[model samples]
Target: MRQRTGRLLGPLLVLLLVGAGPDGSGETVSLDGDRPGERLDVTLTRVVDPAGRADSERLVAVELRLENTGSVPYEDSPAPAAHLLDTAGQRFTGTAAATGAGPSLPDTVTLAPGDSASGFVTFRVPAGAGLAAVQFALDAGLGDDVGHWSLS
Candidate 1:
């Protein structure tokens, strides 16, 4: 019985550690998504609102830090690779033009092991849209892994 308990403890400890991530408001928390050999750490730094009514439709932006913790390189493309999901399940795709207004990910970033890249993904949102989450892909849907962050 003692040997069996010891064996279980190893896996249990790993689970406990893996479950931990950046703390969030009571409504949500940041998450780290990994699939075997590939790992991504996604953190939602902040959400920026539009400056005025005229810009409201194309100004909202979500700032994030994307880290490649895997041993492989993460290829980045010029095309939009992320989307904002609102409370009502509406999807706001990333805007290419909006990226010029702020610090953005490179057109083609190839991350080495333990490397990271930070950037802003802007979206055209309705006046009353409430963003609750973000979905990001390194290969724009061609790859099997995607990183998700919750903002409740």
Candidate 2:
């Protein structure tokens, strides 16, 4: 009976950990991409509001780390599409104009198996807006698999 309990406990712990989605800030999420056998492990490393202010809109930079954990190579020439949602349910798309906030992600990245990359995706939000979450997807937001990270 002790052996049986130990066997069941292992899988149960795994499920509990994996079932907990990336709802907490700084948690890593594993999601499949558009292609078969393609998986990406993503983590929201940090979010920052730079000190400089050149416009009325605020620039929120989200730093992310992406790793190719599957067998196939992951390639996104223009980088993945990312969206920032506010507490009021308003959504904002990623903007290149916000690159001034910090070091931006490369326009293109190709990662082989076990490769990883880290960069920032910036969004232009209202000065008073409260951020809620961020959504990232491959294939320019057309992919079925979208990974979400809660910011609140």
Best TM-score among the predictions, by candidate number: 2
Cα RMSD of all models vs. native, in order, equals 9.0, 8.6
Tens-place lDDT per residue, model 2, 1-152, is 00000112434622222222333446676767768888887777777765235488777888878899989998873234778889999988875454654677777778999999888887778888887887777666555566666665
lDDT of 1 by residue, 1-105 (tens): 000011124346221112213222121222222334555555556666662243546466666676777666666652376777788999777754444447865
Compared with the true structure, the alpha-carbon lDDT of candidate 2 equals 0.68
Candidate 1 stretches greater than 4 Å from native: 1-36, 51-58, 99-101, 142-145
* lDDT against the true structure, each candidate: 0.54, 0.68
Q: Candidate 1: lDDT over CA atoms? A: 0.54
| Model 2 weakest 10-residue run by lDDT | 1-10
Q: After superposition, how far is residue 148 of candidate 1 from its true place, in Å?
A: 3.3
Model 2 stretches with alpha carbons more than 4 Å out: 1-23, 50-54, 77-80, 96-101
The prediction achieving the highest lDDT against the true structure is 2
Give the per-residue Cα lDDT of candidate 1 at 50: 63
